[model samples]
Target chain A: DVKVTQSSRYLVKRTGEKVFLECVQDMDHENMFWYRQDPGLGLRLIYFSYDVKMKEKGDIPEGYSVSREKKERFSLILESASTNQTSMYLCASSQGTGSYGYTFGSGTRLTVV
Target chain B: EDQVTQSPEALRLQEGESSSLNCSYTVSGLRGLFWYRQDPGKGPEFLFTLYSAGEEKEKERLKATLTKKESFLHITAPKPEDSATYLCAVRGGYSSASKIIFGSGTRLSIRP
Candidate 1:
């Protein structure tokens, strides 16, 4: 089955630490996205990439960055982890024009302390 | 601005109950509306995608219909296994058509 796989399901990081969250897709989609879901705030996009080595900032990309070195893999990086960054992070991928529904990974729940 | 709002943040129904979840949206231009089912601690599973008004799609006990301003996910004869959070999202014809906005979601609980 076509799938988006996130490297970790749960992660704990210390404040000021640099964090990396990895995502890989088997579907060879051209678009990949990173979002953080929080209580009462829903899901907020942090960044997205439409092609390898091409990344764009989403609505909430202040403390985050992304790397799409390869077509099937996208990585989300936290410059410096903070307590406010604790939330469930999701990764999704889509193909073609991206008008279709996305295939999402199970998600990574991260805690910063 | 693009925005999505889902009604009835939480709903509780007995087995065999039928109901609908609402997803209201406003965007520069509507490209697609999507419905997803998310079990606790899991990612959202794609259910349906409606491109225009009056379009409908069905799977098992779930049906999704879209209109110019909103979309609805109707559940018929729901069972306990159907209990999950339903999420609605919209893709707009904005500069970045690839960006999708998601609503807070409706948590549905079906009691057997």
Candidate 2:
């Protein structure tokens, strides 16, 4: 079974603070993704990493950035967290291009006050 | 632009009732379609993946079928535990990394 674990389940931060959400996968997947899920907007991609030190901007990557220093870990960073950045952040990983399914972390609900 | 749309924003069903959830999509090229079940305050759990038209996959009382433009997840004699938000996602062929676009999801409620 594949396991994807997030660093935090819930977090609270003041406005203009820097926030970091970490995700680790045990399956040695090559692709990792970060997304923020909202009520009506659905899960919008924030960033994704295909390999170590390789990153790409997803649809909604303006306020967010990501790091993939290693194959098993991916981190999402908020340069200056604002109240609007509060959301349920999700991390997912998949083995390869041909593999369709993804293993997801439990998610981190961040609250920016 | 690639997109995924799930219909029937919410559903209420009695135990033993049967129904189906719909997911329609438009993309330049289709790589795969995925189904997931999510409870409140939790991340999605992978359920099934449909790679092509005419493909079907099943688990327990849930069955998923795919067509050229849409996919259906049929629940047969559902139970209370089957209540959750069903999500659909599509992988576009343009990216080699298999970037996925997700739908807003359909919330299902089963009462006994």
Candidate 3:
């Protein structure tokens, strides 16, 4: 089946540490997105990539960045992890301009302390 | 600003109960509306997409209907396995990238 795979299901990080979350998609989609879901806040987009090596900031990209080195892999990076940055991170990919629905990965729940 | 809003934050029902979940949106030139089901500790799974007013779609016991300003997901004879957080999202023409806006979601619980 076509799928988006996240490298980790759960993670624990220390404050000020640099963190890396990896995602890979089996489908050759052109668009990839990173979102953090929080209670009462819903899913807030951090960044998205429309093509390889091309990345754009989403609404909440202050403490995060992204790298799309290959057609199937997109990575999210936290330059300096903070306690408040802890949340469930989701990776998603779409075929075109994102007018259609997206196939999402199982998600990574990161806890920062 | 463009936004999507879901009501009742949560709902509880007995098995075989039928109900509907609401998603209200205020967006410019709506492109599409989407419904997803999310289990605890898992990612959101795509369920349905409604593109225009009067459009409807169904799968098993779940049916979705859309209007100009809102959409409804109607559940018929729900089961315990159907319990999950239902999320609604919308894409708009305000941007070239077709950015999507998501709602807070409505958590549903079914008692057998």
lDDT of 1: 0.92
Model 1 achieves a DockQ score of: 0.69
Candidate 1 residue runs with Cα over 4 Å from true position? B94-96
Better of 1 and 3 by lDDT: 3
Clashes of 1: 0
Candidate 3 lands at a TM-score of: 0.97
Ordered list by DockQ, greatest first: 2, 3, 1
**What digit string (tens of lDDT, one per residue) describes model 2 on residues B1-112?**
8888898999999999999999999977888899999999999999999988999999999999999999999999999999999999988776676678889999999999
Better of 1 and 2 by TM-score: 2
Q: What is the lDDT of residue B28 in candidate 2?
A: 73
lDDT tens string, model 3, A1-113?
67999999999999999999999999899889999999888899999998999999999999998999999999999999999999999999987764677889999999999
lDDT to native, each model: 0.92, 0.92, 0.94
Tens digits of lDDT, candidate 3, B17-92? 9999999999999988999999999999999999999999999999999999999999999999999999999988
Candidate 1 global TM-score: 0.96
Residue A43 of model 2, lDDT score: 90
* Local lDDT at B83 for model 3: 99
